[model samples]
Every structure is written in structure tokens, then in C-alpha cells.
Target chain A: MRTKNQKIRDFVLSAISVIVLIALWCAVSTSKPDFFPTPMATIERLVKLFEKPIMKVSIWGHIFASLKRVLFAIGASIIIGVGLGLIMGWNKKVRAAIYPIIMTLRPIPPIAWIPLIILLFGVGEFPKVLLVFIGSVFPILLNTISAVSMVDDMYLKVGKVYKANTWQTLHHIVFPASMPTILAGIKIAISSGWMVVVAAEMLASKSGLGFLITRGRDSYDVALIMVAMILIGIVGAALSIVFSFIERRLCGWMSS
Target chain B: MASKDIKVQVNHLTKKFGDLLVLDDISFNINKGEFVCIVGPTGCGKTTFLNLLTRLIEPTSGEILIDGKPADPHVHNISFVFQEPSAFPWLTAQQNIEYGLKIKKKSSEEIKSQVDKIIGLLGLEKFRNAYPHEMSVSMEQRVVIGRAFALNPDLLLMDEPYGQMDIKMRYYLEDEVIRLWKATGSTVLFITHNLEEAVYLAERVLILSNKPAKIKAEKKVDLPRPRSVSDDKFVEIRKDITDMIKWW
Candidate 1:
């Protein structure tokens, strides 16, 4: 429940967005009717979409498929990326040995792997998951490496003076101190994974929200395409919001 | 190990930064339970002298002895407080104060008791749970000093610990340092650019010359306890040190 002032503020902001969006739709629809849909028509089509079967092969199905692929990719990236990042950051010898390989591989786009991915993993979940992992892993690895390496030397000295062993120093000081930047990287990873998974699914998978959008485009159902697009936007926004909330709570001490 | 025993002895300590000789064959002995201040001009390498004593940086040549043996920073039991309070951002005041003891592997009971004593001693009970960001600059510095003192080190090395403070806060913290020094009876070697601060706190004031920094002058400040800046002899010693520093 919002207070009266809060309600007013929200309504005003929402109204401003609606007005701007309507003006944009009007301009685009008039200028290029074939490529654009009016605001009212899009809303009516969206309502028709919600009225369809809510159970099997519905929005829930697309949502679940997309979410499952995203989670798998994120999990894999965290495991491999954080492990490699820790090694590279903590050990100079390891950093020297592996950094060149990482730098060389990091430049290739995740989407550019579509042809290779289809050849290797076929038109299945594996390709989409792998693409998402590729999208998410580099930022997490780089951020973690930089964050851990940049911890103040004084703190390390203090730990040594107290006779803290190697494991103790890493666990108690290094990990906690570098967590803010790591969490920011995690937020970026999740959002990027979602985006990359959608593109990967459209190119490979037979099912999922991305498939729905591609199929709708083929069949000339603009309403279905618009609905899928809106779902993507909403999910992306929600994921970013959730990650930001977690980041704020986890790194709250820094603000104080 | 100190038991009404020897303090610090730096023997033939020659520290060079590449080709530049910072501390050239320097040697000094500090007695147990003494407050000694080193004063020098802006670029005289007073900071380098303290860093050698603290073993933050290894001396380019020669060695340091605490209680007539080689100094091990880990076991020699010296706590350093830098000019700026460097409380870890993530830890609250209570946690920061207890960090050294926790690192030394003290039992929880010991940590609690020591933290409680220092919090009360420094009048920091109100902000006990506050993080460094939440406290004023002076309060943050107070916590830094309190934390160092809680270690109960045999020797306390401070590098211009109150240099970043306002005049009023500086005096108040100086008095606190004096009070803590008297209470613990730990040997303290303080470095400062402020001539008045050096004269105010130390039994002996050692002044260093410009780069290739060596001891240019030394004065024994024989003032009584609870000395005031307004006192005639105190002002006189401060002026003499000021003049010596100007000469450099």
C-alpha cells in the first residue's frame, strides 16, 4: 500500500511514460504502418494473449524454459569463472600463464558462436546454455580478478602481523573485501545471460520465449511478437532489480 | 619480550631508495616506557625512519633489534597507527578495535574484555557499533588509536598520528595519546612535522635534515607532566626546533 504522496508520484511517472510511448507509437505507425503497431492495438492484442490457455504451452511454459536455461548458464559461469579468477588474482605465476589465453578468447561475441554451437550441440538446450555462459563468464572473471588483486596491501600486512595463515587471510580478508565489485559483476552476468540466452534460443531451440517471438514473426502475428518482446523487457528489468536489491544488502556496510 | 626491560635499538640502519640515501647509517636506542618524538621538515624522511622501525619497509642495509635481538614484525609486538585513520571500511568500530587481537588468535572472552576496556578508555561506547564511514574524521582516528593501544604492544610506532586533524582536535588527541602512554607505559616513537606536537609529547625530540636524511639535531625536553603550550619553556623549545627546521 502506497501513501497518498507516493501514489501521486507513481501515477505521474507512469502517466509521463505512457504519454511518451503513445506519441512514439503514433509517429512510427503513421510513418511506417507495415513496421509499427498502434498503442491501443498492441494493448488489445496483449489482452487477447492473456486470455489464451494459462496452463500448457502458455506464457508459463515459455517463462519456465527461458528461466531454466538462464539458471544453468549462470551456475556454470559462476563455478568456472570465479574459480579461474581466484587463481589468476591470487597467484602471479598462474596469472602469467593463463591471462593471454583469456584475453584472446574474450573478444569473440557469444552470438558469433551460433554456427559452431549448432554443429557441436545441435538444436538443443546445450547450445543456448553454452552461449549464455559465454556471455556471462568474462565480466565475472575479470571483475573478480581485479577486485581480489586490488585489496589494500596494508590489510594484508595486518593479517600477516597477526600471524593469519594463507587460508585465513584469503577467507577472512580477501573474499569479504572484494565482495562489492564481485556482486556488481554478478548482476551484470545475470542480465547479460538472460539477453544472450534469448538470442541463442531464437537461433537454435524449438521452444522458449525466443522461439515464440520468431514463430510469431514468421506467421505474421504482430500481437504475439509484441507480447514476447514485452515479456523479455519485463523479465530483464525484474532480474536487474532483484540483483540490485541483493547487491545493496550484501554491500550495505560500504555505504555506512 | 618486555618486562620492565629493553625497548628498541636500530643498529647501522641505512635505507636507500634506489640511488638516493634516505637514512644513512642511522642508529638509535629507545628506553622502555619512554615517549620519543622525531620532528623534521616536509621532505626530511621522518616517515622513512618510522617505517624502518615498524618494518613496514625493509631497510636497504643494517638491522633493527627489539630487546637486544633481531626484530620480527610478527612477534616483536609493535602496533603502528598511521597519520590517517585506516579503519577497514567493512568493519564497525568494535570490530576494527578487536582486529589485531582476533588476528593474534585470542579467545572470544579475551577479545570481548579488551574491546570493552578500550571502548570505555577512549569514550567510544556510543559509537561502538558505528562503521568508519558513519563516524567523523576525528572519531575514526580515535578508533584507530584505541585499536593500536588495545594490542598492548611493547613499542608503539605512530607516523604523525594526529597530522590530519584540526588544531582543537589535534590537541585533544595529543592529550589522549599522553594519557594512554602513561597508562600503558609502552615505549612510543612518534613522527611529526609539527614542532609543538613533538615538544609537547616526547622526552627527547630528534630532528632530521633534508633528503639523505640524518639526525641534524636532538633536544632533551625536560618539561614536567601535563605540560602546556602556553608555558614559557615549552614555547622556547618549540621556537628553537622551528628555527633548526628552518635552517635545514
Candidate 2:
């Protein structure tokens, strides 16, 4: 009962805060052109963005462009991370060779490699995707490795007692056992990837939400910039919600 | 050849971790369908002895022969229930019980019948589809026990499986284990530090010494089925065993 009441109370407070912020904006601004755009102006600008083309692409096109890069990079990183991390965690020979290289590269920030990335790959979708991949891959890879290595000894004993062969143990025991931690890593990777794509776009792209934000800045359209920022925040929130739903579905056994 | 009734022969078994001897030249024979308990002090390498039986780790310098030959996991159908919660968290009660049958490549029909029987026997019908995290600890352990018994193993080794539970749960699970053991008639090597637990479950109890564990004493529990703790013989035997061991 308390939790239910708390949830309702929190929702109400959040709505109130947003209303107050909007009211403050309207109160502070005049009908004439001003430094800060009111909520009404921001809404009008957002509606206009959907109605007409900006920078030769519709609003949906720009959103899709950003979404595509983040999704593609995150997807590729999950595949690579699972593959390499499992190999590293299981096979000693590959682990010895590949483990140190990853450890060395892991501490280096993905954004720091932007200059080199742009120099090597050129300012294109590939560079932005690569940046997001670098930003996201570590959490997934490291968590997968930890998950595999850290499987409880008791479970392995159970496997041995049940006469599970090497492959059977890996398939039935290790993989499913690694899932909860891997999902947690995926959650981290996704948010990190989303943040990286915007920065990557701001640095390189000619189109995207980040590019749209930069365009707003270049044109000195405060309402346009506000629209882009609001869109980024909303999309970020939506991505988080979607990922949480996926996590609950995949690791239902862990739900409590 | 040894008699057909003998399931396992541990001849002069010993294990060493570096120079320190853990188990010192212990030998025993478990009959084909006997329930035997190995009782020892805490940290007395009882689990180590169980490990040797399972062949999870190699003995430093001895052999454990089953069926008058080498005991290898691949050749024998062995199952275990550890003290810790070893139920696969990803699987439901029913699925966890079916795991071994699937690994042994039993037919779908065999798997279904065996799983259904065990679930019914354990009274887990209501929670058969529940995952490990959803059930109480005792219920989860029951699921683990069911998983082990589903295989109907030639040898079932349980290492202090009820040691972590409360007294009520411990007694309840022990009764459940005994019921399963009686039903399956499987050879069980149960290890425990609890004297009452050993007395309650085992047909015969083998008590081990402190470190470099050796069979210090062996007592046949002649009490009736579902023996009461307050019964004269049960209490006497429990007291006798307690007096024999220098647990600390």
C-alpha cells in the first residue's frame, strides 16, 4: 500500500514540477522575440519540424538515422562481445593472447579516439557507428567474461554429478547462467551507446538529431535547439524503457 | 569378483593437498542399496571424501572402485545434492528435475513419466512451474533433491545437504530424502557434521576423526522407520556418537 501510494505521489510531483517549469518559462517571456523561447514557441517549432523537411530530410528521417546507427553498433557489439568474451573466459590459450589486449584498450575512452577514428574512417556513418560500438562493447564484453568466469562452483559440481559433457555444460549451464549479468551489461552498453552516438554525430555527421542540434546552434534558433534537446531526452528515456522491458522478458527467472 | 550386492569399494583411500594429508587411508564398502552416512567434525574434509567418490578431483594416491572395477563418472550414473542451493536458477522445478534425463538422452516419454512421478512424490505439483527464486529455500532444496532422484542414480552422494536449513526444515528434508532413498533403493553416501542427522537417516553411521580423517567409529542404527529423537535407543545412540567425537 505504501509503495503504491509512493508511486502515485512521485508521478504527481513530477507532473507538478514540469507544469511549474513551463509556467515559469511563460511568465518570464514576452510575446515579442526574446533570448529564451517559451514552451509555446518550442512546441510550434517541434510541430513545424515534422511538417516540413529540414536539411533535405524529414524529422522522422533524422530520428531514424540516429536510431539506426545506435542500434546497428549496439547489435554488432553484443555479437562480438559475447563471442570474444566467452572464448576468453573459457579457452585459456585465446584468453592469454586476447585478454591483455582488451585490458590495455579498455581504459582508453571511446571519445578520445575520435580524431583517429575520423582520420582513419572519414566523417561518415561508419565513424559514428564505430564510436558507439567502442563506447558500448566494453561493458558487454567485460560483463560476459565476468559472468562466465564467476559461475558458481556448486553448479559445475551439479553438472559433473549429472554427467554433463563439456559442450553440454557450456550450453545448458554456462550460457543461461551468464544471462542476468550479460543483460545488465547490455543495459549499460545501450545507454552508453546512445550518449556516444549524439557526440559522434555532433563531431562528424551531416544529418541526425545531433546534427539537427548543431544546425539549430549555427542558425541561432533557440526554439529549434530546445526542440532537439527535448527530443534527445525523450528518445533517451524511451530507449531506457524499451531496454528495461526486454531485460524483464529475457531474465524472467531473476524477476523478484 | 566381489559379491553382487556391493556397489562401491573404497580401498585404502587417501588425499593430500600438497604435503598436508586430508584423508588418511580410509576404506569402506557400500552395499548395493544401503543408505550410509559419514559423520565428521566441521572442516574435516568430508566434502573432499565425497569429491573423491564423484571423481570431481583425483585422489592423491588411492582408488575408489565401483562394481569391482574403476569408478568413473562416464561409466556410472552418479547424482549429487550439495549443501548449497545448486538448483539451476534459470529452470523451473519441473525443468530442473528433467535436466538430467535430457542429458542422459532419455526418451521424451521416459522424461515426462519420471519427472511427473518425482514431482508428485515430492508434492511439488503446485510449484512445478515456479523458478528457484520464486520458491522458499526449503522448497528449492526439495526441487534439487527431486532433480537428483529423477536420474535414479546408481550412487547418490549428498554432502550435508540439510546443514544450512533451520532445525524444522532440516528434519523435514531429511525425512523427504529418506523417503526418496527408500523408494529408489539407490546407494546413498550422505555426509554430515550433525550427529542426529546421521543417526536419523543412516542405516549405519561411519564417524570420522578430526583432520586426516579416518573412520573413528561405526554404529548400526537399528531403530525403526520414522524414528523419534526422544526414543531411548535414538537418544542413547545420539549421545554415544556425540561423546565419541572431539568436534572442536
Candidate 3:
């Protein structure tokens, strides 16, 4: 059904877009030769990383350490954020009481909490976990609240007329109806959370991609620094792709 | 749970929207198996009455009774088909119809049989797996009606269920509803602004006054079964009701 000319046009457009992007990256990266590496150099560093041995502690060690932190942090975010969001959305009293505190806290950036988190939890996994949780939880919570609030009142009435108890109604009506927005919030949380992990780990963790970047900078090893940067982009892309696949499979019903 | 004559008694049902009264001390009795239509002008509290019946909103100063028993939403077999095609967009037509059955804890086989019967009866076999977004407005309305009827409720409340449809589709759905009503014998209290639809569908039509609405008139259509709009008597009654709605 697709026209040959249209496909050719699309291909050319994609190729041009990539060429322009690479050219722009080359321009920016090459401007400061001592401080920045070229696109080709970064690719070379990435290829070198692949040739290295895989183990619990190698170049991949930092990757694993960062991944662990991100996963745990995201898990905590989902539990606390989604639970509170649902409560705030479902109950007016809960929303009124908790919303002011959340608003007061939300304006402060996640990185700003590093000092306080380190102060309370000490410079360990707890601080990093807390930072990621703080970074990711609000988006999920706020989105869930709005999503649940926006659900058509008719569905709830339908639930009531069917004599659905509180738990059943929440499961059958509110959750499913609010899923699309919740998923969107999770998506935003995830990408932002990944970005935060690197920054958090750079500041604190001794064995993470961010730590690797810091180590590279301290040693003045530009190749390793570029490798870490490349890795961050790759990991972010991979997370989005994986989450999107799961979302599509689970929520195909919602689109129709 | 016994199959006996049940009367839905509304006693001094007064409703207000802040300072503006919507239903002014309205009262009525809907007999078991009777189909009554409440016809009124815009903002005449017809919807408020239906909402009160389903307890979507509590009456400002009254209670609804089923026979001698007080109205209980948890125990009452009451279902609604709204003016908007209110089928859950995520669920297929079949699933929407099966929703009430599932919630009521019907056996799978029973649910299957009932769903199949309703789908076949409503000529919705081809569209059973289609979600609400994939359907035309009329098709979505059919799904809504089928879902309501699947429960086999003791009383069915419809709030302008056909007002959104085109004229041809409305007539077709109206006929379908009448057929279903005859087959199931459920008591129906329909709220509509359309005088023609009220006359065509109901055994008795209750007319309400404008704004601070109250029951202005009630007319029993003793016309024969499968009433025709083209019939002279049907036209006469329709005209009278139209004038009442237009003026009052």
C-alpha cells in the first residue's frame, strides 16, 4: 500500500536528519578539542568497551551498579507514588491534607536533597536510593492523581450500582481508567530517573557509570569519559524501548 | 427475590440546585412491569428524577420505596442506560455486556449464554468484540442498552438514551428497546425531551412543568400494540403533548 516514491522520500529525510545531527554534534564536540571528544571518538570508545571482559566488576561493573540503583529507586517510586496518588485522587480529604506538603517539597530539585539525604542516610546506597525515589516519585504521583480525578463519574456510578466494594471498584474501574495517564507519568519518571542516577552516582557512588566518568575526568582520560557519556544515552534509549514494548502489550485494549 | 408486583413509590421528592428548585415536591408511583416516560422542557428535572431513582443523587427531602420496602441500591436490581453512549471504552461490546454478570458472580456458562442471547437479540454479533471507539454512535448505544438488559434488572432507567442518535437510528433503537422491554418485562422509567419518543415508547407518559419542575399532566396511551406514528390518533396525542411541552 505504500508508494515507492514516498518510501524513498522518507529514507532520504531520515538520512539527512542523521547527517545534520551528526554534523551538529561534530561541530559542538570538536569546538573544544582538549575538553570534548568527536562523535567518531565516542563511537570508537564504545566499541572498545564492548571488547572488554564482562564480569561483576569491570567496565560493566559501573553499569551494573548504576542499573541496580535505578531499578530499586524506580520500584520505590512506583509503590509510594502510585499508592499515594490513588489515595489523593480517590479521597478529597487525603488530597487536601497531603497535597500542600508535596507541593512544598516538589519545588526543590532532587539533586538539592543530596546533602540532606547523605546527612540522614550517610554516604551509602540509601542516599542514592532516596535521591532517585525523590526524583521520580512526584511525576508518577501527580499524574496518577489527575488521571484518577479526570475519570468520568459515570463509570464510578456503574461500579456503585453493581455493588462493587471499595477495593473491587478501585481495581475494576479507577485503575484501568487511569492507566494511560499513569503510564505516561511512569515514562517521564523513568527517563528523568535515569538522568538523575548518573548525576546522583557522579556525586556519591564509588562504582557506577557516573563514578567512571568522574574517575576518567580526574585521570584526564577523555576516551573513558566519552564512553560513559555514550553509555548513558544507550541506557536511556534501551529503558524507553523496553518500557514502551511492555506498555503496548499491556495497554493495547486502551487505544481501541 | 420473589417475582411479584413491585411499586416504586416516590414521596415528596423535592430537589434544588442551590437556590433554584429543579423538582418541586414531585411524587409518583411506578407500578411493576410498567414503562413510564417523563417528558419535559429543557432543565425541567426529568434527569434529576431518574438520578433520584438510581440514587445517583439523593432527593433533597424525600425517599424512594420499592413496594412497601425502602429503596436499597446494594440489593436493588436497577440499571441505567445514559444519554451518552457510556460503554467503557477499553472493554469490547461483549465484555461491556458481561460486566454486570461478572460483578454479580454469575457462572461462566451462564454469562456466556446470557451474553450470546442478548447479542443475538440485539443483532450485535459482528460488533461484539469491537470497543466503544470503533463503533458508530448508534452501535455504541446498542451496546449500552445490551449491557443494561444483560443484568435483567427489576427496574431499568434510561436518561435520554436516544436523544443523541439520528432520527432513523433513534426509531430503530426505540423499536429494539420496545422489543426488549416486551421480552424481559422490566419496569422502565425513561426521561426524555422528545414528546414523540415519549408517546411512541411509554404505556403512560408523565409531563413535567418548566424549571421548578412538577408533574403537570399524565396521559395513558391506550392505543393498540406496535403503535404507529402515522395513525391519526397517534398524531393527535403527539400534537397535544408537543403543545404542552412547548407552552408549559
Q: Top model by lDDT, which number?
A: 2
Off by over 4 Å in 3: A1-11, A24-35, A53-61, A254-256, B1-6, B16-21, B60-62, B243-246
Q: Highest TM-score: which candidate?
A: 2
lDDT of 3 at A179: 89
Candidate 2's residue-wise lDDT over A35-91, tens digit each?
Answer: 778888999999999998787899889889999999999999999998788878777
B182-227 per-residue lDDT for model 2 (tens digits) = 8888899999888888999999999899898998988889889998
Summing lDDT over every window of 10 consecutive residues in candidate 2 chain B, give the lowest-scoring window. Answer: B239-248
- Residue A215 miss distance in model 3 (angstroms): 2.5
List the candidates' TM-scores in order: 0.87, 0.91, 0.90
Candidate 3 structure quality by residue, lDDT tens digits, A1-256: 6699999999999999989988997998888866778888877776776676323357777788888888899999999988999999999999999999999999899999988888888889988978888889989999999999998998988887777788878888899899888988999899988988899988976888888788778889687898898788888899999999878876777643
Docking class of 2: medium
Q: For model 1, give the interface RMSD.
A: 2.2
Q: How does candidate 3 fare on TM-score?
A: 0.90
lDDT of each: 0.83, 0.89, 0.85
Candidate number that wins on DockQ, 2 or 3 = 2
The sequence of per-residue lDDT tens digits that candidate 1 reaches over residues B1-248 is 35436578877889989898888887777888889898877877777777777776899988989887788876778888877777777888999999888878889998999889888878889898898889888898889888788888878888888888999998898998988888767889888888889998999998888888877788889999799999999999999888888875
Query: Second chain of candidate 2: TM-score?
Result: 0.96
Give model 3's share of reference contacts: 0.45
